[model samples]
Target chain A: MNIQLIAEIMGTVAFAISGAMLAIERKMDLFGIVFLGIVTAAGGGFIRDMTLGIVPPAMFSSPMVLPLAILSSLAVCALVAWLYKGSDEELHGERFQWILNFTDAIGLGLFTVAGANTAIDSGYGDYHAFVIFLGMLTGVGGGMFRDVLAGIMPAVLRKHVYACASLVGAICYLGLLCAMPRGYAMFTGAMIVVVIRLLASHYKWNIPRVM
Target chain B: MNIQLIAEIMGTVAFAISGAMLAIERKMDLFGIVFLGIVTAAGGGFIRDMTLGIVPPAMFSSPMVLPLAILSSLAVCALVAWLYKGSDEELHGERFQWILNFTDAIGLGLFTVAGANTAIDSGYGDYHAFVIFLGMLTGVGGGMFRDVLAGIMPAVLRKHVYACASLVGAICYLGLLCAMPRGYAMFTGAMIVVVIRLLASHYKWNIPRVM
Candidate 1:
């Protein structure tokens, strides 16, 4: 498989898991869990496609995207059921937090670059601001939807350097595209986002919030 | 101006006022209030345009939409400031509730028909399900976004028959298209939604909830 395809699959799986876990935590019904999981994986693409005027959206056109999201979400649900067995114990521990952070960072990075690349391919390469904004939006939009459905302020808007990490990575991708092969630029940009996000999480970095 | 233009303007103003009022109730900053107001006014059209593959979306291409939303929101803000005068009296009474309901219903009805018309004009008239869905989505999408930003369950999904009202109206529009002119169909459909919503609200009609 190509690197871009791999990144897309990995990002989809990670986001599905993230969304399913949140739905479970919220004690939502089975339908809600699956719905949230699918939306979290694909909602950003929907937004991106709409803005870029891609009819039917990539998620709808791609045969595997929706199926992948469904399978991943179901797998998460099965795993959680097997492990917790309906217990009320907290789902987070050190290792769990680490896993969540790692997977989320990877998903954010991959999706951000993917979105930027799509924008570039769609003739938006000249619009640096729009490209970067689309990239960041693609990375954060799903999570924002998830949070909204869960009746909470979007975490990206409130806490951490999540969106900033995506923003910086998009900028890096745009800068590198001039000096390197497209694939290399994408890889490097995504890696930068992943690294920055991981470090920010480890250091508890947060943007200033107005109280 | 055409009937469609008039409906669009009224919808924009009503939705903006609704969003601004909610923001004020939540004690958000000025920026938050305006942002929420504009999103509530234009977010649905964004979703619709995106799905229909309309580049730049109508809100961006039509200079009046955004400016109108901003001005309407600002007017609401000014009026609220003048009336409340920084006092914490509750904003709702019988008259206030009636006005809010009347305006919201009108906005919902007009937007629903407008969205369905757009869908039909885009050559999706044969797809009955898609047309109805797009219409209902246009009616409720902005309020959904507004509620999400305000950290509350979407009112359309919960209290009243808000979305259902839009759905019925869309179906009515489609049905009426066979018997009347497009303008008459749109007007009649919108009126149906407003009446249904008002009646539902007055009678406290609610869908079954899973306890």
Candidate 2:
């Protein structure tokens, strides 16, 4: 499989699990759980595709992605069901945040590079902000949707260095592309985001709230 | 000016005002008010455009729409500021709901036609679901964005028969187009949505909560 495709699959799986976990935390119905999980898995790419004017999106154009989204959602939903099957107290627990953060960070890293490269491949190489925005959206857009649907402000708006990490990763990828081959540059960019995000979470680094 | 243009303008104004009002209710900062207002005015079209593969969107493509969005947002923000200047008690009052519902209904009517027409023009005429989905999204998508950003459940999910009204209007428009002129069909369709939405609100026709 292509390296880009590999990154995309990894990102999708990680993001889908994170979303499913959030749905469980919210105590949403089965429909809500499934819906939110699918949305979170696909929403970022949808946003990026839409912003780039790629109509029908990859989810509709290429059949594989949507099924992957559904399958991953099902897998995550199953995991959550099993995890909380015996106890109601664990339902509202914060114990899962560490695992969620880890998976989310992995997704953020891989997606940032994928989104930035996709933009560059689409002939938007000259537009710095466009590439960065697409990259950031691909990294965080699904989580934003999940949060919004759960009736909470998106973490991107106030959370610890989420968008910042994506921005940096995208910029790093774009810069590295000028000096290195695509594969190496992609790996470096993904690492940058993963490391930054993980460190930020561990250190509790946060963007100051405006309000 | 064209009838479609007139409808678009009216919808923009109504949506912008509705967004501004919601921002005020949330006690968001001035920037949030402006951001939410602009998003509400153009967000639906943005979604429609993206789904249909219209890149850069009309907001950036035509130039005129973005300014119109900004101007409408500013105008609405000013009106809200003026209205609530005297007291904070009335700020949280239910008095604004009437005006908000009226404007939202008008927007839904116009945007549904605009979205449906755009989809048909894009060669989606045979796909009934596509046309209806686009039409409904164009009508409610902006408000959904507004509500989500404000961290609330989307009104279409549980509120009055808003989605029903838009769906009926889109189907009506599509059916009418087979026999009538575009102008007549469009007018009739918009009226159907507006009337149905108004009636739904008046009668409190709500979709029951599943969860």
Candidate 1 chain B: 10-residue stretch with minimal lDDT:
B86-95
Off by over 4 Å in 2: A126-133, A175-181, A205-211, B1-43, B50-117, B124-133, B145-153, B156-211
lDDT of 2 by residue, B78-171 (tens): 8777877878887666778877778788888899998988888888676666687689889989988998898877876556476778889999
lDDT of 1 by residue, B91-153 (tens): 655665576668778889999999998898899999999999999989998889888787778
Task: Return the DockQ of model 1.
Answer: 0.14
Off by over 4 Å in 1: A1-117, A124-136, A145-153, A156-211, B92-97, B178-180, B205-211
How high a TM-score does candidate 1 get?
0.63
Candidate-wise lDDT, in order: 0.82, 0.80
Q: Which lDDT tens digits does candidate 2 get at residues A11-117?
A: 88888778777776776655556566667777888888877877556655554665676787777767766766767677566678777778888888888899887
- Judged by whole-model lDDT over C-alpha atoms, candidate 2 comes out at 0.80
